[model samples]
Target chain A: MAPPEVHHLFHHPIADHSFSADRGTLAVARENNVELYGKTGGKFQLKDELRGHDKTVTGVDIAPNSGKIVTCSQDRNAYVWEPSPQGWKPTLVLLRINRAATCVRWAPSETKFAVGSGARLIPVCYFEEEDNWWVSKHLKKPIRSTITTVAWHPNSVLLAAGSTDGHARVFSSFIKGVDARPEPSPWGERLPFNTVCGEYLNNTAGWVHSVAFSPSGDALAFAAHDSTVTVVYPSAADQPPKAVLSISTQVLPFMSLIWSSESEIIAAGYDCEAYRLQGSEQGWQLAGSLEAAKGRPGLQDQREESALNMFRQMDLKGKSSDDTKLKTVHQNTISTIRSYEESGGVVKKLSTTGVDGRAVIWTL
Target chain B: MAAVNWRTINIDALDPDSPANFDLTSLAPAVAPVSTADVQSLAGHIRQLLRGGDSEGALRGALENPPYGADERGKDVHLATIIEILQSIRQSEMSPILSRIYQSDGGTEALDVLMKYVYKGMGHSSSATATKQITPQATGFSQVHGRGGSEGGGQAMSVLLSWHEKLVEIAGPGCIVRTMSDRRVV
Candidate 1:
């Protein structure tokens, strides 16, 4: 396979990243602000910065259809940014939670979004037409610990939340007027606010770091700190799931994951590289890493690769010449991965942001 | 309780066709009693590596294998072992070793891995708990004048502070704060 495209942004931890529908603009959560990058030529150039947040911003996402951007931070706040002639206009969202907002995602419909918080709740927010304000309804029934991450189903009403509590829960976020009645599926028929359709925990009870729904919305997969990914297939609301398959790996815990297709999942984290896991209801397994290390490279005998160069590398970095650069593009743990482009329900391109502050896009 | 009762997706019973169930007990270290023989040997190995001036090697040993095994339990074992190694060594012995590691290329990643172990070590009891029980011992360890008083390990955060100082000493001031962002620590 060909190597992925790597973009070295500023050196800092990227908590999360999102790409616009047209794949032209990118939003990344860096420290307390969200920086917007516009694609210029074959590279991404920083075009704008949305700077309203006071604390470290944890999550940022762009609505594909409406072209709106939502960002949440540890400062217990969320904002929705709309593109205007004067750059991007920010509108604060009233997420009534006392703790830090851990993650946020714009729903598939673009009319709503979900914010997972350390307050042990998921607030499903949508605009209030009468009030001209963004109001959130709390999904606060059974979440016992911090909601670490969340993903909306293809239908938008079925929301999947992964929490530090070790639970990957499917909740119905159907609003009366904001959303039309969603078609019944394996999740449930008469869906209402906070209706948890299914909840699954890993065998090790590890914190759920990332969760994703298959394009068909028939399956739910979550990666936990245990270095395992468990896929759950729902049979019905009342029946036991058709199957719950958990695949454990020897690698470090995965911080983020995305479903590329019905049976293919790509995840990465402390390992500093991504891996592909393919499976069905019958079983799942780690196929291998997306970043496979090439053979031991031939030595570069150029002047820069000489003994003096070795000393220069060591004098600057304190290591031998060869060991200074990592084999992978990302120098540190990757925190987030998203589907940058998809067609006919299959993800065609993938993007990841890491603690080393590099954003990379990959083609499947 | 009834409203959320629909979530019964925990797979206690296994399907014969699926892969073997993950051995959660193996990864259950932090909560596991401290008397495990594995913890002692691992601690000794790390100390040996550090004292031998192989800080990067020692850190790699901890990072790659992580005697607790790689999970929550491994996280705890890692935290305890790091503290034990730090507390046992003399400041004179540790500074140069850490300096060498920080000067290395992947030093930033090493610091990050240690920071992760620190975060997991000073963690909430089993994410299911209502409130985070900041385990006092894990949060900050008292400097035990254990070994002819080489140097006080001070506390957990202090160990980090000392590492920061040594990196600054070896390289410069900008070397540390930029490399290790301890925003989550505060």
Candidate 2:
């Protein structure tokens, strides 16, 4: 995980966030809107507010290519909003799943996407468009359970979702029709196949708060409320369950998990400090400690006073006043994370929604 | 003579077998061949077998009968009775009698019976008397028996209409059906 070097504080706690695939633009989720930030002058500057969600926005994702943005909200709907030449406009509201989506991810090809929600009745949904209209598939099970997060396998439509019960399920759908006509049920019949990816066992333990699959589909990373982050490799059968690394960080109800560079590094955000894994070790070794937004030494005393005033008033939803009290200590809560692909694992950006009511972007 | 539990039996006895037992072989004459024109008689005969009222005579009649027709409606009734008896055969003390009907009839009757009432029981038609007028026919009977004994004719369509058609083409329609697709000798 990259060290928190530049802590950009937001006014509200960040419900969720995403760094553009090219590292050019960043999007943050808030109560009913998303804020776009531009990376400049060693910090993030608010570019624009993209608003359309009727309720609290829980998750936001940027397409790998077209810069199209898709956001999910507690209102039980996911919408695709594009930054058009005229201005930001809602492109299409993807079919609604029956529950609030905890997380969403775009396929590497950016053609279709998966949405995971809290309702087990329809745990996951896939979206695609044929002819000129958009359509979706609601894949439900005879039995029900809640799904918390979803991640698409790199370069493939394979989807992996983390459930509240601490199980991770993999789903694959095949669409035979090409670009010519509408393909029937892009999310095909659910295959009767899944594996017990991980378990939350101590006391009440914790379910998987976040899940991520490696770029090559060989490895998996899960951050759970069990105060531990588990890394697994599902490619090897016949081998016993392997936990590459475990962390003792106490992630409350919701945690964020992400993969860095080559998937060899795993990054996670908890209530307090965010951590990253650097090797194939059993226990996660802390790479860097998060620091707060500080007034630069080069600035004049008056400027520093003004900067401190801004930082003081800045309240990211997940962090407390004490956590934000000092200019040298990064707030304890982290809502989201993004790894800059081109930057050689140097600055991992941390997006934290603080108690100050802002979406803060930090480079760690 | 001994009480047999049907649920515990191996998958083989779940259907009929060719090697007849003494008890079932003796009642073959009473068993009637399900026909093509009407399934009411065949269903009645199956009713008698289930009642144990005159199963020996019923089995004897079944052996002497020819085969049933493939009219969808009539097959439905015959299938219902076959499935009901097939499932309860072990408990009836008429296992031998039921087994004989299943075997000589080629699993078709047994399968239809299983499909109709046993495997997926009927829930739609609540009134039993509503189905009384249905006549049983032996439309695809020859196709079932033709597999083992070497009968030559066009293959008849099995219950699984689509899959059976493909199988007949693959198995040589002439040696399979005993009748052409139009019911005329080819």
Candidate 3:
């Protein structure tokens, strides 16, 4: 295996990041603006910056087919940026909630998107052809607290959301005109808008941090603050789930996760490393960490302490030096992990951005 | 009748965070109600297990079924028994016992329940110090306080803190977060 490719963009935390379909353009949420970097000369160079948001931009997602970028911010708003010949044009999305938008993701179909917010609601927004503007239908019932993350099913009709109230719910975001009626699945049959197909609470009632649907869309996986990843398989429309496998770990809680395939999930969080979890409806378990455990240089260097090095270190800082850097690739919490490249329902590469301000591309 | 002015209704006044809407207790896992008598019997059994040098069994017994439906006094009695068992175990035995419990069935939940007791014990120890300061006469009747009551209290607190550290090492910081967020009373 080759080492992961690291890109040190800046010293600021990247709340979210997305790569375009062609893998030529990258959009990252930095502070109050979304920076667009284009691949140039075998490197990602600053191509443009979308500067419309007035508050900390929380999320940014690029539609793979349309190349349209959607961004949400703490200022309680979201914007859709369309690439034109001259430049990217911005259009505001009418998310009527009064609280900040926490996350946004373009549906697989690219015709709609869902925005999770600090308010106890999720707004599934789609473009209105007659009105020529993006309008939102709110999913409000049964949500008691702010939503932390939202993921769209493969069919673009079913949506999964994790909330601070400790519930990971699957709801129908089906729009009458925008989305074609999806085939009946275990989630539901009459997929009307705002229909909640399933709701699951973590065993410890820990606040759910991130949620993702399996590639097949038949299973839902969520990472909660309890350092546990729970996988739920729906049995039928309005019945008990077939299985609810909760894989608890003795590590820090996962902040974000992505399904690399139907049976494998890659999660990253405060541990400053990505971990692989593999299992199925029978059971699931933590396989191990993705990063190979390496011997620490600090430990090796401590054994060979020399007088010349000690004096140099003492003269430089007036005290003996200690290793301040972490042993992992990310020095801080990894906030987002996305499938960079996929083929035949299996992810070939993954990209992750973190508070350490480094975007790393890892090939699997 | 005049048309109702819905615009001036102050929708935010109906706060979603109200007690009715945010009833955290409802999220607790449903368990068969345990009475005070049952808790007392279980505590006695746990004490017997501890006497037989089965500390792991004692710990598991204490954590397996917390008195979720019992009164405050009943729960406190059970909590004191658990603290006694926790303090009796040797420091060297702590990690081994925790690892064994962690690997067993429903081990994560057992650890979570133990974390709740650890936090509650810490809270009681701190509050004991506060009451001793505010009302010195309260400790006058107790013979232990006449010599080194505060010292003993401090020692117990240190023990609880060490247990907390060990628990975190085995269960990760998620245990602390779960204990803090859990609304179920032990």
Candidate 4:
């Protein structure tokens, strides 16, 4: 319609923001709490606050078909919560592991989700009949080190997890009627249709914090703490990902990466500015930068009582007690960018969460 | 002799109950019966009296004396509920009511009340000898202090209802007894 207006709904100053595929809604995993936002009119409205993590939450993702949200914290527990019609209430607390989950992603179908902890990547599938969830058998490789990000392919068939070692391996779960190849392993398990691959991409020594795939299923984009965004193209021609786009820029460590719908542009969210890339030769440029609210240099430079007071004064009303208060549990500026491709392709939407405690929804 | 002394001066001796020219409502809490300790204390005392074969005397004393517990900002039904509940628990002889009351308000206020009641009730007594005070533990009442077995039967309902009535009575008929256990209660 209008080339999608970019609006930064909020600027909460924290550490980071993690987003989901349905850009209409965003769940931010902050240091203390997780926040959910819904797109209303042309802006993002605070929809829910999911609490109870003993420490800072590191990642968040929303399940499909419903508003069920999953978040992982440094406190070593990952919880799955459902938003109540009345407010943002936690429905169920899923698993509480003894390790911190740095990254999380829900499968394209939303039936299951995955998490990255230390050097291990754990994929948990929800069993409706059992009313429980179990870790996927395919992810039993025991990588032996820290995994920074986990991303499920759009086809819901492959899952790619990246780590500090600069290796991003793709795995296939081989659901029935899919990947029915004969058993290849010693146990006749056909190796589960899952394979591991690694590459020593130049200058990828630091932790790979973000992993994403092009909407077309052709290319995979990853950003590492090395301050580089690396795009991987399939070596084959049948829908092969051609051309590796590596853009190096000196901003805050590259926290997250995403590809535009057409796969023509790549967006990397930095600490201050969001970088956009056309290709390696063209290099990377700042797409959009968040400017502090006019009055002060800090988060709430104007003499407001508190962030909560500022939020209350905005007349922000949600489904709960004083939902208007801006004092959200998770306060952080967004260091990530993503877009949702609607069914009819009529609308392409963009949403973001940041450390400043703001979730902005953009119309594309 | 008294008349001569009055002339000599007795400004310090003022009539205690003389009709005061000031209203004292300002010195009082907006409502009464809000304290857990007060309700528990009154409940405990009445419970003791009822257990000591003074049920009729205790009820009569409560009706006449009307001891509102620790909180002075609650309604009259709080007192009523305390009296009613003590009477029920004494007659039922069920100890699980403490658990019910403890969990009734999510255990916030009820536990406080139950804790004080149990502590004071069983603090001094012993069942082995008449000379020794009967303690809850000495009476072989382990259910009251066990981790999961503390729900005391109908006594829980009495405690809750008593609290509800007291809040309504003191804070006005519309006053709701919000258990300390639940922040959502208004």
Question: Which lDDT values do the candidates have, in the order given?
Answer: 0.76, 0.50, 0.88, 0.50
lDDT of 4 by residue, B95-164 (tens): 3443333334223233323223322223222221233332357444544344223333334544544534
Worst 10 residues of 2 chain A by lDDT: A178-187
* Runs with alpha carbons beyond 4 Å of true place in candidate 3: A295-305, A311-320, B1-11, B15-24, B27-33, B133-147
Give the alpha carbon lDDT tens digit for every residue of A36-88 in model 2: 88878767778988887788888888987888888887887777877778778
Cα misplacement distance, residue A338 of candidate 2 (Å)? 1.4
lDDT of 3 at A297: 28
**What tens-digit string does per-residue lDDT give for candidate 1 at A188-258?**
89898889899887644677899999989999999987677899999987788999988756467789999
Give the fraction of native contacts in model 1.
Answer: 0.02
Q: What TM-score does chain A of each model score against the native chain A? A: 0.94, 0.71, 0.95, 0.68
Q: Which regions of candidate 1 fall more than 4 Å away from where they truly are?
A: A295-322, B1-186
Query: Measured by C-alpha RMSD in angstroms, how accurate is candidate 4?
Result: 29.7
B1-186: candidate 2 lDDT, tens digit per residue: 258886676653442322221142221123344444456677676677768856444434432332433454655655555444433433334444534543453433222222223212223222332244233654576445433332111111112233233323332222131121112110
Clashing pairs in 1: A199-B7, A317-B103, B29-B73
CA error at residue A343 for candidate 1, angstroms: 2.1
Give TM-scores of the second chain, every candidate: 0.41, 0.29, 0.79, 0.24
Report residue B115 deviation for candidate 1 (angstroms).
22
Provide the lowest-lDDT 10-residue window in model 3 chain A.
A294-303
TM-score of each: 0.66, 0.51, 0.91, 0.48
Error of 3 at B6 (Å): 18
DockQ of 3: 0.44
In terms of lDDT, the best-performing candidate is 3
lDDT of 3 by residue, A250-340 (tens): 7789999999999999999999889999999999988988886654222344467688988998999887666787778887999999999
Per-residue lDDT, model 3, residue A301, is: 42
